[model samples]
Target: MSTPPGAAGKGRSLSAVSRDRIEQHLKFLVGVRHPVAAPAALQRACSYLEDTLRALGYAVDLHGFFDGGQEYHNVVATRLGTRRPEKRVLVLAHFDTVAGSPGADDNASGVALLLELATMFKEWRPELTLQFVGVNLEENSDRDGHGTGLRGSRALAAFALQQGWEIEAVVVLESVAFAGGSVRQAAPAGVPLQVPPNGDFLAVIGNELAQGVVARFALAADSFDIALPVVPLVVPDNGELLPDTRRSDHAPFWDAGYPAIMLTDTTNFRNPHYHEPSDTLETLNLAFAVRVCQATAAFLLGMAGGEGAAPS
Candidate 1:
């Protein structure tokens, strides 16, 4: 793998990945943030995300749409590219959860990292317009998730297309915490690909159009301060053959013919607490989550044309 651009010469420090802040964010977000189940918590989550992005010097936009006669929101923060303003890159995480589950690992972890990344890249001059989006309603109201759960992302994709935006990449973070243990990890049933048995690695899964992005992320992970084990999987036909790969918001972008990838911990495959009330802050590994931020910083730095060093 090629060396990640902007990696430190001798040593890399994860100082930019603030563990305390990530934990704080997670603490505030660890609740049943469903519109119907915990509407207050869900509104609070949206406001917090918007306030955080505004504090980071971003012009935040609340993309609202009506679904089932109820208004839903997607928090979007845009940082225009310095060199190539037309090219765009997005980092997003869904902020809503199932009815009963607090969704700490299901998505609070992902939201915390998304906020941290937005803070880390605030001052960077990347070639691609960096967008940090907090999507809502990713978790379907139905238990089987066969309904209109991805409406937020699908609407955003359609809006991007309407504006004729040139999207370079879309990185979706889903259930990124809960790593490092003796418990064995399992691939989705009947999938032939070989994965490490231990639940110690982050899975970077992409569609055929996102092959290069997946490879670049793997290289970026290698150059970070910590040893972040990554399993890079590229699927054909936009992961139609493996339904498990299409579980998150990135699936909608793929449907819009845009390049997107999902960074996850394999969800139910590794996390026994998936969609359970037990998926709380105490169950997450914050250090592992910090490492994910560091790796993502490296990836964005490389995409910035290797012009300047990443935050310390």
Candidate 2:
């Protein structure tokens, strides 16, 4: 991928991410994060995210919404800014896993990275308030594939809309671990952009309006010592026509006319265990996950205009 202008000078190093804590969160979340068969397990996962954010000194809020006659939850924790409190930047992930699967790489990895971001920025007061969110029902775990995904994000977006929250940008964390040099990555039969032959890369998927956010993340990660490859993919204004691009929580923000991007390892493009039971923690590249988290922290801090933050 071509580096953006002055990308080398952006973002902080990857020193803030703790591999041990990431492993702990991944083990705990992947072990009990199946939201379809067991609702209690899903609740526990949300609780864990809430408590961790709270302990990290963020003001937490629980927003409840219903879908399919069932109540689901979204946790929004704010690392209140000392400067521009009205301006906001969001980082979020779905805590709910697919049915009968552990979802280590499918989602637990993203949630773990969210927590790591919270830990890294606990003491730094940024200009834009960072709303760390844990959304629910992102997976069509009920086996109903017809417009069932992104319920939680839709709800959160609705809340943001009704409240007239001035969201600067949103970073939706998705499947971001697992990598290899295999040539199994494939897009639609005749997609416009090129899908790299190898799966060892993080795809920064976004729409036209989100190109700025995508470039910011790539630049932030580039400043660090990370070796992982990043592929920036910008969808057209009519990206809704593409099924592959709308496969995550970030789509809801795009639908709401808000700029957003998804950080992920192309789901099922290289991972054989998309929603399968074989998606376990052992299969994840924890080091790669850490790099993604580190980059995200830098991106958020830079966007928020935090003190000691790198150039955005």
Candidate 3:
């Protein structure tokens, strides 16, 4: 486990997450974002998030990169820790949707939750820096995830290493907020675990290094009164070493030797509209999205050494 020297501080998540705010962010992201095809639209979407984070008093950091000859942008909103500003915990989600889809649950939900957290914790300064990142170019299978596939995340991970920032943990939210009435989630093939018959639970997948954080994440959900059927997956290797687990932005952190975990609703494994045009806001389960934000607040607060005393 290549973890930083800091320990998870005893603290509970403070602040109530507004469902309305979550909804608005989701609408704004999914309704406005365009993928590989529309550069101008994608830039506009990035600007939208950047402006919102700025309004919430977060210093927005843009990491610009090029993919397949097209320049892409990643939006970072940071709330530096008062006690350990040198160490950081990253919360990231790609804002760019795949071409031909609206991407409500695919990722807009992820960014919405990230935005909500940025707002929720804006004033509650923690002991570790919290970076809410809206990454881009994550859906491309061509980037080899550990290297190329994760455009924005790969760059951010490299930048953190170059700057010698002590990364306590990196949490990536993807395909969140799509659960209802006994939904059964299936783990990727060969990763042995009997998924409940109902795919209604949220999944937290981590590498061996992230085992401890994953445990706390489940407990945090319960502590925050978010009754999610949370499933914690700890890959025995550098998750990127395995094909099944290296599925999202979190994969790059593991490749960079940082402890990272992903919170997800398990895209195509459950939702039929995974990358289709039908992946719109109307199909999303907003109530489920709210639970994700609440649970995330709990996990982040504890990780950031904030005021909440979640379970050990």
Clashing pairs in 2: none
Global Cα lDDT for candidate 3: 0.79
lDDT by residue (tens digit), candidate 3, 1-312: 112222233343334778898888877778435554655767877898899999999988888777666677889888788777889999998887776788899788998888888887777667888888999878764332333467788888888788888998899999898887756555566766777766788889999889988998998787656667898888887764457678789987887889999998888888888889899889888888887887887777668875432212
Which wins on TM-score, candidate 1 or candidate 3?
Answer: 1
Alpha-carbon deviation at 302 in model 3, angstroms: 1.0
- Which residue ranges in model 1 land beyond 4 Å of their true spot? 1-5, 8-10, 142-146, 306-309
Candidates in order: C-alpha RMSD to true structure: 2.5, 3.8, 4.5
* Candidate 2 Cα errors over 4 Å, as ranges: 1-12, 32-35, 141-147, 308-312
Q: Weakest 10 consecutive residues, lDDT, candidate 3? A: 1-10
**Sort by TM-score, best first: what order?**
1, 2, 3
Answer with 1 or 2, whichever has the higher lDDT.
1
- lDDT score at residue 179, model 2, on the 0-100 scale: 74
* Top-scoring candidate (TM-score): 1
User: Each model's TM-score?
Assistant: 0.94, 0.91, 0.89
Measured with C-alpha atoms, the lDDT of residue 91 in candidate 3 is: 93
TM-score of 1: 0.94
- Residue 243: error of model 1 in Å? 0.6
| Clash number by candidate, in order | 1, 0, 14
